[model samples]
Target: MKKTIALLIITLMVSPVYALEALSDDALQNVEGQAGADLSLKLSINHKLENDKYVFDNGTGAVCADVQFCRLAVSVNNRFIDNNGQASSGDGYKLWLVFKGIQGTINIQKLGLDGMDLSYKDDGGADKIKAAMQLSFDATKPIEIRNFGFNALAFGQDKFLTTAGVEAGSTNASDYGYLQVTRYDTSNAPGSVYDHGRETGFMGVQMNGNLALQGKVMMFGCDASHPRC
Candidate 1:
């Protein structure tokens, strides 16, 4: 038994050697050339701004009614796909939403996963979604979020995270504070809003209405606590 175990160990150690399939001279040269080929990409999003139709609060995150649905689109390599997998070259992706202002936490009642459509210059590599995910959030005031629920890696490809980040910010009283997640749901949404407790730092993304907490309000420093505020 001891001799058999020793042989098995040796065999396992040498297995990769046989699995290495060697290529021919021309194949090897072509493979080497392809390795140095230039592969670049860019991602852009198009969205139409709308009135504050989504319900937001310092207590309950965000809630959207069916009557008010905004649109979000993503454009990459001159092509786009909707959340339902329809492809278009002129317009990329279009996601429905309800906008709000005034900072708070977010929790989706039923978050769904939408796959991605990618276009590459060279088609030598595998054709599959490299990553996919869903995200959730918690609410706070004086505006803070610290918890996240994530669902990721749907297919048998690479491990992914569903939740991305929790973001909050505000400007005027009409559009001053809001919270949001990275996924959409038509039913049974699951998420939460964090007011205060031990679960504060669990959120990866946070925006503060005040600047003393090291958080940014508007992308351009609109909610300044300094003399400019």
Candidate 2:
């Protein structure tokens, strides 16, 4: 019996033991939950004029010679209605909001995202819970945007109209569309010449700033519950 007991004790000491146990409420309360994650983002945009054309580089060694830059065009109020509420014109007549030649370096450090509850006033003036995404950043680290600029903010019937009167669907160099404002460069100027060292565009915006932003973007349904959905 003593030999058998000694052998079992040796086996128990060498082998691994597995067991399941229930935690008390207080113990569970003391347990720590998983913390969220952190994020860092950086964007570098560069552009230059080569042979009367604009070339782009996105921090990489490769250069884009095909007039490839960030461009966003939105058409608003494209549908025209007659007095009888009928369609009047085709999809040609559109007021375009174009943003072209976006070049800059954006740096954001330690941007945090987490789940949070948001409260807002309902349509009946009662406080309610609105779904939201919590966006938080380190106060010590501001969101930095350096050399931020765009070529144009044009408003016209077509998004592809050039200063040379070349309409849309033309496979010309001016096919990138007419810009109400352009960058301060010779390629944007008349006859490829700088206008007395002045920007030829309607407006020139050179933005470099460090912005501090921390908030929750609330999102909810556009139903009877939300007044300003």
Give the number of the best model, judged by TM-score.
2
Worst 10 residues of 2 by lDDT: 158-167
Clashes of 2: 1
TM-score each candidate: 0.17, 0.44
Query: Model 2: per-residue lDDT, tens digit, 104-210?
Result: 67789768876545666876788766444566767678888776777545543333422322324545534333323344554554775644433233544567788
Residue 120 of model 2: what lDDT?
69
Query: Lowest lDDT 10-mer window, candidate 1?
Result: 150-159
lDDT of 2: 0.55
Model 1 C-alpha lDDT per residue in residues 120-151, reported as the tens digit of each score:
22244533222212221222222222221211
**Which runs in model 1 stand beyond 4 Å of their true positions?**
1-63, 66-77, 81-205, 213-229
| Model 1 residue 84 CA deviation in Å | 13
Summed backbone clashes in each candidate are 23, 1
Clash pairs (backbone) in predicted model 2: 161-178
